[model samples]
Target chain A: MMENEVDGLDKRKAYILATVVYEYIATGEPVGSQALTQKYNLGVSSATVRNEMADLEAGGYLEQPHTSAGRVPSDAGYRTYVDALMSPEELGADERRRIRDEMRDARAQLDEIVEQSSRLLGRLAGNLAFVTKPQSDTQSFRYVQLIWIAERSGIAIIVTSLGVASQSLFELRNDLSPDDLTRLSNALNATFAGRLLRDCDDRSLTALTKSCGFGDDMAAAVRAAFIGARTQEQPGISASGAQHLLDQPEFRDVRKLRSILRILEEQRTLYDLVADAFDSPTASVKIGHELGSEELADLSLVTVPYRFGERAVGMLSILGPRRMPYARLLALASGTAETLSERLHDVEVK
Target chain B: MMENEVDGLDKRKAYILATVVYEYIATGEPVGSQALTQKYNLGVSSATVRNEMADLEAGGYLEQPHTSAGRVPSDAGYRTYVDALMSPEELGADERRRIRDEMRDARAQLDEIVEQSSRLLGRLAGNLAFVTKPQSDTQSFRYVQLIWIAERSGIAIIVTSLGVASQSLFELRNDLSPDDLTRLSNALNATFAGRLLRDCDDRSLTALTKSCGFGDDMAAAVRAAFIGARTQEQPGISASGAQHLLDQPEFRDVRKLRSILRILEEQRTLYDLVADAFDSPTASVKIGHELGSEELADLSLVTVPYRFGERAVGMLSILGPRRMPYARLLALASGTAETLSERLHDVEVK
Candidate 1:
């Protein structure tokens, strides 16, 4: 139980909490007061440190997993330390260079970028890395095409400024000849080119058909095809390096491992869990318990959005046990986002 | 330890081996002679069955996991039972109908077929179900289009009779207008339509440029774009329902789970492991030792090639514990393969 009206941490209490969290992350063991005092200069004795640890535990900064065990950082403890005590570690020069080079190689194949980014980030952070493909909700339209396939059905292709083409099969109320599809394709392209893609909605699809002197069939096909393409072409999330979790002692229990692995398999759950990455520009950490889920009480996620120009297009994130090297993993994520964004600018049309 | 030189099983011994394998799979424990006789109707006396069990153990068909424990089937035992004794179980009518209807709903879009097939098959089989995208080595080309994007580059589009389109950004040797691109696209379509897609190779790509009275730049773009699209568009394997393995006792050890999952994530390893699915027209089972890998010594794979019309276009498989119900899974695979092939024929082009 935590006291809601507790005062903020004093200087000595803050130092002890930081040292305890760091020690626990390194050893995967609860940190005792004696160990913290002996390992670092806290300017105090073990008895005095023990008293401070008890007070911190009551305030919900630390937790004793077992009655006899030493204290470890609670989720609240981790949150405060991340916000105040932890200093971001600078990534190695070689690591940052490799991220930049590999991302540049991935280039315009957005699918490859998602797969490769997860792999690189997973290996670098030594945790499960999650990446959502870079796509902007406010993308601008470049062109639209309708190709005749049969008597009344055709394929609608929409090209976006993001250098992607979304295509799907469509049906018309009346049979349209190849010449008619060609003419309609040209008219649609002229109307929507260089405009925000969201501006071309279902209403415009129907309104354009009548205004362009076409029948209701054209509107039916255009609306159906455009909506279908948008839904099917939405970018997906990739979770990589699950094997990395095998080494963590916390996941030795197969039940615990199953819950986390099950979450990884559920794409919608992962997308919702990491959706906060898109809420801000800088990297943010989500620790266990703070996520409001029982299964994920021992896990942590660090998410940062990668931008294309001024628009935040996608996210790069890492998920691991709550006892993680937060300072290092945060640095890795922010550095990767920056590198991926810079590399995207090199692609000609982006 | 196992012995290689042995004669085939006689009637009584075969019955004993089959029953033991069944009991072990269900109970997840060694099949003691006493327990087998009590649970099953072995006509002979308990002492007589025990004597046969000792003989079978000496012949290497079975082995005792511990000195004090009863016997379990060896890999060789499983092989002989699968090859000679097991009878394939028929899939339930409701299950078969579900597979057929769901596959029909996934027609036209090959990616959706792959994803949905894995999910459905994995649930039905209760194991890690793997499905490779359906594509034929001798698929016929339907049409080609070159759309101008900028001064020297455009997008290459190849539509196949499989109702699938492969597209990639391409570069040309010189600037070509929308009219020039239309002419070149027509020429290429006339040369390759309704012919085996394999007919279009690197050399033919260049030769067609000369024959069409187009510059070498056209040949350069065609070859690069076609090869790039083919490589990027190849159907990948989807390993789904990994969570289904949680109920099995064999994977209680995290090490085993890690090894198998690491294999699943490595697309190349999985592709190689199930490559034999393309070798024959029938469903085949590869037992533990038959795979010849140390990491997978306790696992088995069942592979079946799903067809389109008369040609084998893709594979459906299940990777699970060695002690599995071979008869039922084999029926499931063959049934799924037939249904997917039939559904593919509903698409007009095929």
Candidate 2:
């Protein structure tokens, strides 16, 4: 790795900077030059160590929470360390086995798997974690059941191939009975059972259901509800391990904890966040101000997209204070993404 | 309303105690005798107020946070005030209208109505709030759809009349095609469209499906799954507005806030708490130690069971610090409960 990224710091100096970052994350305290020299095999005198720390601070990679205190890594410092100098810490074998086994053991429903993923990731990472349900753009119909309600209304419950349900209520164009609805439903299901949800465009749906004895009004209303549910709905997120944040030193201040919790509760915000992270095949790291949301300015997020088929449809994330063990957490996030992808693949085959 | 409940404290003395409790709730501070006499027209002198406060403290109705501090209401004090001396604060017409309108506007799904109720109550009550999904012990089947999967397994998706879903996976007794499952499903629905779910005991289920061309194994497995889902499943809860606790003065302590959040996350604990509160027709108040959970020793919970037809099946609750305004929150809890009950009624008729 080319280590001379921060100003005039050479490879040795960058190594010193990474050690400070790692130590601060471990102890939740600043790393002084004297303590650093004594604790790590830096092979340098205290005087020389002090001079390098001062330079690192001047270069904006290190900062002091208090004027007299030793240095902690700034956001820039964390970024550079994660990018160039640091090698990811190995995720434990037991943790990996547990993640795979629990996800495999989850119920066949997509909702159950997603919920278990969030709870497991949160416990493994020791902070808040969340997973978004896969986008339905490419999902095909597993089954559809149409039931006629009172008046001219009907309900259509569509189960996706991945075991998720999308249901909508709509007004029927004709006076349909339970028996008539059942016949029409069976015909519709036979034709579109394995077809892509998006394949039911207005023109094709009209042509297709015309043979099943439904008019333009009936077809249009039903298509509107089905297409609207498939396209307009952003996947909902499941969150877990918020109580873990209480033990973090930075979140001991109740205001910071509240701000983060408030942001997590907003569904639109979480949707936007995971959407932005879904394209990255590996961990996408956003630290402090780089997160853009003011409520998240004191925290960092690491996300990785879990795939279905070839599509990167959903993402899982870990949230922690800025002084987190980024190397291990980044590894864990990507690892979980792999596990979730495998589990989702089995969901279709199951 | 009783003349007195605490020792020999009479009508005049009880009114003085109630006044102190209200004043403390408003200011979040101890009510000094002089301050109380000056602010409220008690028709008595400062000397009388001071003497009465001393007697209330001695009689266990109030306590001093500090020796020299004025007086704050104890749990016993709050109980007496809510039970006898206090008149419930009038919930405004606008507040009642808002609750009704929001609940009425919820989509025709039991789950959506319950979730919306929790968010609305949490905002209106300005604390943590939750709503339990109505129990399915008495729910009747709206519709059931069966689908065949690979390797002799099938799924049963049952929808209750109130628009809640219960699904289960079971091993098939024979090699069933999708058409066979659908035909059998229709036959079953024809016979028992709106029957109570509990009517299908193991013995009756085997006998009924024997003539439908499926073996006892399939019938028994399917019955076990449906019955397990309907009977053993404690209804899941939806909670909202936990961030509101951060602003409460008593929760300003980080430890207190953590304890309450921890308790709120335990689904079983919440299930038990709501179950205990479900039989009461009015607002059920459990203060401090009455909550019976050590983590909730500093908190108070107010619950009111919402009804389905004539049976009490679900409850709504507010959790706040022990020093909450019981008079207003109690009215709001019961008010929200009424709004939710009406909303469920519409779900069925829709």
Candidate 3:
């Protein structure tokens, strides 16, 4: 090992590069070799550290913005640090309790949970925070109930198997008396209860209508409500502390800010992005170059999937400068997901 | 006129600058003085054009990214062009009709219209797009109706004075027979129909309970539904085509992209932005520096308020890179808002 130390400098070079990148991410500034040795106690002299930094630059992990400037992590360097050097610390009990308390106050509404989760994340990360509610497809339908509210108005209430509820209103043409309406309601429940709505096809609709013995007008109304219930499938998405993005140096350009604001206004794209993050179960880190958008290549996303009653249903993540503390962000994201899922399920059980 | 042109260098300069900006917007590149003179036939020599370009840069409206490169519009330059010099061409009949057709297909659903409007703005600007539905507070509640669906389930339908409808559901303690439920529904309509629900205070709640002649369990159920209906009151926001921002030059950095994506997920921020845009009646422009976020100073938002049957209910806008053709984007945003309102009103009328 001692013989190879001088001749093969690969391990020493890797250590110095890793140390510099770690210090840069922690401080959000350029890192010099002297600082790296001092901070990490690498047991190497400043000259050796400088030599390794130069070699790391040649290997594409570290970069010098100017001839005299300290070294900074290139995208490659950050990638290597994220992949090999970082280890996430466990979330402290106080932080976990705080997350649980915040989520508890949000009530059972999915939108509220999403909104609070984002806010909690933004506060925790001190960067931009984003969280998305479970997508409609991910939720199981518990039951669909239709009720007549007025002479011309009817309501459809859909309960998901996961305890989320949604409702929509439609107009009806029937002038049925209360007796007739009561009979129809009973008949509909008997046929439709305990059935998965997505599996309810045209045959099911027809069977529901015929068995209920509802008039054509009532039957048409039921079909319309059924269809409306199916398509009301959107989930809520929330972000917090986006203003904090402006506090970062990378967004100093007014043009860059405008582009970002415009991008933020498109929630559908964001919804898709967050949902895609959940496709991986464990904590996943998507850094610059991995996001597949040239505009997004300078950022890092830390995402972790969350469960609803043991089923992985959605995700929570943070999007920030690529130099973000990946180990901490990853830990925070994972802890948030696990705690949120557990808290939400607990609320439902109660 | 000739004397005015020669003496009024400011006006001519503005014209020449507007020309250069327009040409550059059409082709995402810097505008050289020679190209401006040759392509625009500015009746000036290339040398004179170069001198003017230098003056424009000095005025902070243009910049040279590299020493030998042609000039691009700085954020300030785009601001001046948007506010003072540029005159958007009127929408042709075909473009107007295309916008009308887009709104015509949205049917009677206001939610669908706002969603489609954002997409339309995106297609028009080739950038980010946003649309916000009317705030629930602005509208008065017209009716609340309850219908019994099963032994434990019932649906609550609410219609506002503005003709929009929403629904909710609740569980009941006692199984009110369908006949009794019908009586309760009728009793609710008799007392609450055509009255502003916001005007109905807790005093009215007591009055309603006394007047409905309901049993204790049934009264509790009705009150629950009433509170649910009156308390649910946030407007919806829909947006699309945010991914288009990725194609812009300013967000090419991965850090910028991540921060922007994070901000876009914040619904409250987006809702606030779009709501403020609707506070104006005509085409609204939120330029760099005006947008409150320094990160957004490189962006511009062109928005206009839209109406639902003569009632100003929402706003729709497009988000573009700061160097975008503001004149064209503003015109497109105006046309989109105007056409959407007209077509939606037509649907309402039908």
Note the DockQ of each predicted structure: 0.49, 0.49, 0.10
TM-score of chain A of each: 0.92, 0.89, 0.84
Task: For each candidate, give its TM-score against the true structure.
Answer: 0.94, 0.93, 0.68
lDDT, residue A176, candidate 2: 73
For A1-350, candidate 3 gives per-residue lDDT tens digits of 12223223366766676678778777877888777767788887888888878888887887898987899888878776777665657889998888888778875555667677778888788776777776555555545555455576655555555445445555656665545555665566666655555665556676667676766666766676656555656455667766676667766664555555554556666666565666676778778877767777677788888887666777787888888888888878877787778766542411
Q: How accurate locally is residue B206 in candidate 3, as Cα lDDT from 0 to 100?
A: 55
State the displacement of the C-alpha of residue B169, model 3, in Å, after optimal TM-score superposition. 6.5
Evaluated on CA atoms against the true complex, candidate 3 attains a DockQ of 0.10
Model 3, B1-350: lDDT tens per residue?
A: 11224223487777777777788788878889887888887888989989988998888878898988899887677766676667766778899889888777775566677777888888777887877776554555655556555676665555565445444556667666656656666666677665555555555655566566655556665665555555655466676776677678777665656555555666667666666766677777877767677767667788878776566777777767766777777778888888777656532311
lDDT of 2 by residue, A1-350 (tens): 45445445697789898899889989998889899999998899888988988988988999988887999999889888887777877668997897888787776667778888888888889988998888886777666677666658877767777765556666765677767666767777778778777775667666766777877766876676568558747777888888889989888788888787777767778777667776666678898888887878878888888888787888898888988888888878777888888888766724
Proportion of the native interface contacts kept in model 1: 0.31
TM-score of chain A of 3: 0.84
Better of 1 and 3 by DockQ: 1
> Each model's RMSD to truth, in Å?
3.5, 2.7, 7.6
Which lDDT tens digits does candidate 1 get at residues A1-350? 11232238887788788889889999998988888889989889999999999999998999999887899999999988888887769888998888888776774665666787788888888899988876544566776777777778777777677656666667777777877877887788778777766677889878887787778878887887666545544457877888898889998777777787778766778888877667787788899977669999999988988887788878898999999999999888888878877766544242
